[model samples]
Target: MTRRITVAGVSKFFYLYENHSNKLKSTLTNLARLRMRKRRKFWALQDLDFTVDQGEVLGIVGRNGSGKSTLLKILSRITVPSKGRIEMFGRVNTLLEVGTGFHPELTGRENVFLNGSILGMSRSEIKSKFDEIVTFAEVEAFLDTPIKHFSSGMFVRLAFSVAAHLEPDILIVDEVLAVGDQQFQMKCLQKMEEAMSQGRTVLFVSHDMRAIRRLCKRVLFLDQGRIVHDGPQEEVIAMYLQSFEDLAHIPFPDSESRQGSGALRFENLALIGSDGVPRDEVAAGSDTILRMRYRCLSHLQNVIFSLTISSLTGQILFRCISTVELDSPFSVSKDGVVDCRFPRLNLNVGGYLVEIEASANGVLADRVREAMRLQVVKGAYYEGALPNRQSQVLVDYSWQINPDGA
Candidate 1:
């Protein structure tokens, strides 16, 4: 297959300013200064080189400020790179934000045609696919309505529909799929799969590792505006997760303020591994534990504590509960600390969350929303098999084979 997209020696840099004057304006002024300060060059992407073959789907994963969005913008021609060159052989459709080229005063119908034209679609071509776009977006009722009046959900639907159905040779998507509900997200994923089957090239950027693993054959990990790792889906994701120590250790002011609410107050939470040492890292498919030490402030019974793991993209992989599956509820008197183990963690390689929630007397007593973040380091665990326990809810499967001399 011929290479459809080539990013050669790409480097993007911006100036981050330092100070601002006014109080309310100070924030805005500071942000502006942050964007334009001299002597402070922030590299959003540097020395990045990659090639996407025709019909290939590539996933870019990184934290905020890692240049994933910048790279997408450069590729989509929304922004020019400070350095480097990108070669594209075909038309590219991008859904970087909810309303990229929309005119607020224009009706949905007009904007669809306008956005489609901007994406290189002819008027006749857009008209031929007009109903399909509206139907997929489910915005028939608001088609004639001005886009400014549409809700965020409606805008997302219409925008995604225009980007997807136009059949551009290369599709570049950022986190726009995250704006809608679960059903719409699933629909978008399905549409991407359909596009893949049709042999279109896809460049996908997402913080959701699951979507990346499910959709892309290759992955790239960026850190501080540089492509740190690029390879197979699993390997790249694993490397990315292992690199989260920089995040977990960044001290938050008054850490106690972030504690979960419950009869028991969380004293400390740390990710520990077989080494039995407190670590900000853990290997995938390894024996790891989220050791959360909590002290009961008062006598409590029939209390349940749970931890939920989610990708940064807001995908929940699995949740662990102490009381339900363990089938044991105990009373805590006065003050004491207990650690719960999440054995053989089977999460795909990515940054995950360890949320703490507790219920007492059949009601929610205390809970912390996304209390802690964890990263799953890649190891030689899966070999070729899928991670364990993923069979139940995360993915569906089927198999086919042709027997010879039947």
Candidate 2:
């Protein structure tokens, strides 16, 4: 495949100021206080070097502050890089902030052409695709109505449709698949696949692991404005998620970081193996017990205890709830322990985070988000096979292959 885009030694930094007075002062002292200004600078992207090839799909994954959006903005020409150079061999289109140029007063039909033209489509081209766009967006009845009157979902649908129908050589999508309902999301994914089949290069930035795996062949993992890992999709995604293994886990209740009402608080968490002993690392495919001790700050009624096992990236893999709407709820008024036992931990070897929550009378009493870590080690998940790669889950199944000549 031919190279479609090349980013070499690129970096972007922003000036940080305490207030308007400081900002004006810094601007005035610009060249005179160059060294001082450098100290007050925040680098969003630093020394980024990569290339996207035609017909290739690349995934960029990272934490919230890891510079993914900044990089995308630079690539889309929405902003300029503070340092280094970028080379593009083809037309580039961005889906960042899907409805960036939308006008509230413009009718949906008018806005579609406006957005299409902004995305590099000609008036004739937009005319040719008008029906398809409105049909896909499912806003036929509101075609002549102002977009401001449309619901949020309807607006997003039209915006995404106009942008997606374009035939740009390179597409940059940033967390846009997370919009709309499930069916709409699936349609967006299908459109992406169609674009790929037409030999267009794609740069996707998303936290949806399933979508990332389904579309991208390779990935780039960013951390603190730097490219921490760039490799195959599975390897880079797993490495990025596992990087949260060593976070400082405070077992006891802390008032500073947790969220929720002060009615109930979690005090500690313990993981016990099948041998009746507590341990930090759990063996995959073994029986396990999670014990959480909570303190009641006040009297509580119809309290519900919930525990979730999630990948280090905060994607929930398994959850245990005390009861459902039909089941009886617990009524507690004192500090107690909640135990959630598993017959066999069907999780692949990786690092996972645990979240515990308690609710009283259907209101959130206390919740600890990613408060603890669970490390799963190597174990016998299959009869005679030991896997080398890591995934968030493991399942029991059998496979049979038929002879080709039969």
What TM-score would every model get versus the actual structure? 0.61, 0.65
Error of 1 at 189 (Å): 1.0
Q: What TM-score, to 2 decimals, does candidate 1 have?
A: 0.61
Worst 10 residues of 1 by lDDT: 378-387
Error of 2 at 260 (Å): 16
Q: Over the stretch 245-351, how does candidate 1's per-residue lDDT look in tens digits?
A: 45444433334434434566654566766445444555554456776556677788887778887767677767778876776876766655456675555665567
**What overall lDDT, based on C-alpha atoms, would model 1 receive against the true structure?**
0.73
Candidate 2 per-residue C-alpha lDDT over 107-201 given as tens digits, one digit per residue, 9 for 90 to 100: 99889988888888999999999999999999999999998898767888898889889898888998777556557878989998998899999
Candidate 1: list runs displaced more than 4 Å: 20-38, 148-151, 245-406
RMSD of 2: 15.7
